[model samples]
Target chain A: MIPVCFILIILHAYVNKIAIYDSFVSGAKEGIITVFKIFPTLLGLMLSVAILRESGALNFISKIFLPLAKIIGYPCEAIPLTFMRLVSSSASTSLILDIFKNHGPDSFIGRFVSIMMSCTETIFYTISVYFMSVKITKIRYTLAGALISNFFGIISSLIITKIFFHY
Target chain B: MLSYLWVSMILFGILFSAFSGNLSGITSAVINSSRESVEICLTMLGVLSVWAGMMKIAENSGLIKSLTKKIMPFLKFLFPKLDKESQSIKYIATNIIANMLGLNWAATPAGLKAMQELQKINIDKKIASREMCMFMILNMSSLQIISINIIAFRSQYKSQNPSETIGPGLIATSISTLSAIIFTKVFEKIYFKDGDQK
Candidate 1:
C-alpha cells in the first residue's frame, strides 16, 4: 500500500506538481484536525466498553437472547458483539476473535453474525454521520430504510448458516 | 400504511415473545454500547490524528481542491444540474474524498454540509432535487477504498489472515456503488420524466 501510494505521489508530482504537493499535505492536515475533533467519541466508546466488561453488564445483556440464541445455535454472549458492530467495527472484529477462541468460529453465533455483517449496512451510524456533517434535523426515513435492511441482513445470515454450516 | 403494518408486526412480535427480559437486556446493551462509542472513537485518536492532519495539510495545501477540479468533468456527467460555485458541490466532493479513503467519520460533516447546500437549489419543495437524491444515494452506497469496518471486524475475530477479506470487500462495494448509480438513474428517468404528455 505504501509503495503504491508513493508511486502515485511521484507520478502526480511529475505531472501535476503543485497539486501533488498541496492536496496531499492539505488532506493529511484535515485528517489530523478531524481526528482531534472526534477524540471524545472514540474515548467514550472505549471507556463504556471497559465499564461493561468490568460490570458484568455484558453477560447480563447477553442473557436476553439466551433462549432464542440456543435455538439458533448462537451463543447468547454474542449479542454485545452485534451492537458493537455499529460503534466500532474494529472492536467488533476483536470480539469476533474472542468468540472464535472461546467457542470456535464453527459455533452458531460466529457463523451467523459473520454473514449478517456482510449483508447489513451500518444504518444509525451512517445517518448520524450525515446528519452531523449536513446538520440535517430529519432522520425518520433514513432510519426506517436502515432498520428494514436489518431484517434482510438477519434473513441472509440465517440462509448463509444453513448453506455453509448446517449438518 | 404499509410502514404502519411493518411497525405493528415488529411490535407484536416483541410483545408476544414476552421475552422482555431478553429485550431489556439487549436494550441495555445497546444503551451501554451507545455510551461507549465515544471512547472507542477516542481510542482511534493516535491513528486518525495523523491521518486527519495529513488530509488537512493536503486540503490547506490545495490537494483536495485540485482533485475536485480534476474530477469535475466526470462529476458533471453524474450531476449536471449542480452549480460549480455551490457549497453543496464542494461538500459533495469533500465527502466523496473522505469516503474514498474509508474515512467515514470525517465524511459525515462533508455529507451533511452537502445536503444543506442542496437545499438551496431545491425547486418546488415537492420532492428532493435530482442532485440531492443522487448525493444521498452515493453517500449511502459509497464505494470505499478500504472498508475500515470490515478490516476491524476481521481483526476482532482474530483471523489468521484478516486482510484476505479486503479483496472481496473491494469487489462487493464496487458492485454496490455501480448498482447504486445505475438504480438512481433508472429511478429518476422513470419517476421524473421531464416533459408532459402531448
Candidate 2:
C-alpha cells in the first residue's frame, strides 16, 4: 500500500513538472527541525514515564483497577498495557511483547492487547509534543475530550475482542 | 494541563518508590530513560525525514490540494470556522490520509505543519482555536483502516493469522474516532458558549 502511494506520488510529480528533489530536501529539513522542537518535551515525558514504570507506580495503579478489569471481563494481565497506553506507546509495546512472550501470541489476552494497542493513541505524549511545537498554552477541553474517547476505545476493544475471540 | 501531568507523574514516581524502598530504581531509571528518549527521537528522525520528503513531493504535485478539494465538504463541516481557502485544510487532509494508510511517520510532520498553519490565523497567539482543538482530537483518535504495526508484531510472534485483528481494530478505531469528534463538539458547545468563535 505504501509503495503504491509512493509510486503514485512520483508519477504525479512527473506529470506536474514539479521539482521533487528540492521539495523533498526542504521538507526533510523541516522534519528535522520539528524533531528538535519536540525533543525536550519528549525527554521529560519519557523520563517521568520511566520513573513511573521503574518505581512500580503503574503496577500499583493497575492493581487498584483490577476490580474494574474483572467486572468488564478484561484480562488482569493486560491491565498494565492499557494503563500505559495513555502515556507511552513504547512502554505499552514492550508490555504487549511481554504478554505475548508469557502467554503466547495465540492466547486470548495476547490478541486482546494487540488489538487494544492499535486502537488507541499515546494521548499525553501527543498532546504535549503537538501543542508544544505550536506554542499553544491553553488547551481548554481537548484533554477531557481525548481521554473520554480513549475510554470508549478501551471498552470497545474489550467487547470486540471478547465477541470475536470468544474466550 | 501538561505541566500538571508531568509534575504529578514525577511526584508519584518519587513518592511511591520512597515508600516502597526502591528509591535506587528511580535513580537508575532517570539516568537510563533519558538515553532511551534520545534513541526514540533518532528512530523517529529517520522515518519522519523520509516520509516528510515524500509528503513534500505530494504537495508539489498538487496531490494534497486535489485531495483537499475532494474532501472539502466534510472538512467544512468539521471545521466550520476555518476559511474555505485556507492552506491548513490541505495539510489536515494530507495528515488524515497518511494516518488512515498507517503512515504515522509521515503523518506527524504534516500534522505539525497543519497546526503551525492554524496557529498563523489564530486570533489569540497562546490559546488554541476550536478548529485546532478539533484537528488535534481527530489526529489523536486516528481512525485506522490498516494498523500496520500491530500486524507486523503479530506476524513476528508467529500468529497463525496475523491479519485477523484488522477487522476488529478498524471497527474499534472508527468507534473511537467518531466518539472523539462528537465529544470535541459537545465540549465546545458546553465550555465555550460565550467565548470567541474565531
Candidate 3:
C-alpha cells in the first residue's frame, strides 16, 4: 500500500512537471522542524507513562476499574485496554493481540478489542502532540469532547460486537 | 490541564512503586524512558519525512486542491468559520483523507500542518481556536474505513475470517465519528457562541 502510494504521488508530480526532489526536500525539512518541536512534549508524556507502567500503577488502576467495567457490561479482559488506549497506542495494540492469542481472534473478547481499537484514538498522545505542536497550552473543551466521543465510541463498539458476534 | 495530568502520573507512579516495592523499576524506567522516546522519535523521523515529502508533491501537483474541492462541503460543515478557500481547509482535508485511508503516519504531518495554518488566524496564540478544537476532536474519533493492521494481526493469528471484523469496525467508527461531530458542534455552540464571546 505504501509503495503504491509513493509511486502514484511521483507519477502525479511528474505529470504536473513538479520539481519533485526539491519539493520533497523542503517538505522533509518542515517535517524535521515539526519533529523537533514535538520531541520534548513526546518525551515528557512518555516518561510519565513509562513511570506509571513500570511502577505497576497502571495495573493497580486497571484492577480497580475491572469490576466497574464488568458491572457496566464492558468485557473484563478489556479493562487494561480501555485505560491504555487513552494513554498509548502501541500498548493497547499489544493488549489486543494478547486477547487474540488467549481467547482466539474469533472469540467475543477478541472481536471486542478489534472493534474497539478501530473506533478509538490514542486520546492523550494525540491531544498532546497536536496541541503542543502549535503551542496551544490553554486547551478549552477539546479534552471533554474527545473523552465524551471516545466513551461513546467504545460503548458503540460494545453494542455492535454484542449484536453481531453474540457476545 | 496537561500539567496536572503529567504531575499526577508522576506522583502516582512514584507512590505506587513505593507501595508495590517496585522502586527499582521506576528508577530504570525514568532513566531509560527518555532514551526510548528518542528512539521512537528517530524511527518516526524517517516515516514522517517520507510522508511529508509525498504530501508536498501532492500539494504541488494540485492533488490536494482537487481533493479539497471534493470534500469542501463536509469540511465547511465542520469548520463553518473558516473561509471556504483557506489553506487550513486544504490541510485538514488532506489529514482527514489520510486518516480515512488508514495512513496514520501520513496523517500526523498533515494534521500538524493544519493546526499550524489554523494557528496563523487565531486571535489568542495560547488558547485553542474553535476550529482547532474541532479538528482535534475529529482526529480523536477514528475515521479509518479499513483497519488493515488489525485485520493482518487477526489473519496472522489464524482467524477463520480475518476480514470479518470490517463490518463491525466500520459501524463502530462511524458511530464514534458521528458522536464526535455532535459533541464538537454542541461545545462550539455553547462556548464559542456569538463569535468567541468567551
Most accurate candidate by lDDT:
3
Cα lDDT of model 1 by residue, A1-167, tens digit: 43454454455455554555555455555545555554443343344443334344444556776887778655466677765654445566677677767764445665555555554455434544444343344432334334443444455456555655553
Looking only at chain B, model 2 earns a TM-score of: 0.93
Candidate 3 lDDT tens digits, A59-140 = 7888888877878788888888888999988778888889999999998888888898899899899989998888888889
Give per-residue CA lDDT, model 2, range A1-167, as digits (tens): 78998899989999999898999898898889888888998999999899999999899999999998788788999888888988988888888888888887788887787778767888888899889888898988888878888888888988999899886
**Residue-wise C-alpha lDDT for candidate 3, range B1-198, written one tens digit per residue:** 878888999999999999978899998998888888998899889888878888999999988899899989899899988898888999999999999999998899999989999999998999999999999999999989999999999999999999989999999999999999999898888887678633
Range of the 10 consecutive residues with the lowest summed lDDT in candidate 2 chain A: A110-119
- The residue-by-residue lDDT of candidate 1 on B87-130, one tens digit each, is 67777887787777766555654565576677666653434556
Model number with the top TM-score: 3
If the candidates were sorted by their DockQ against the true structure, best first, what order would they fall in?
3, 2, 1
Flag clash pairs in model 3. none
Residue B95 alpha-carbon offset, candidate 2, angstroms: 1.2
Candidate 1, residue B117: how far the Cα is off, in Å: 2.6
Fraction of real interface contacts that model 1 preserves: 0.16
Higher-ranked by lDDT: 1 or 2: 2
Q: How well does candidate 2 score on lDDT at residue A2?
A: 80
Instruction: Give each candidate's fraction of reference contacts reproduced.
Output: 0.16, 0.77, 0.84
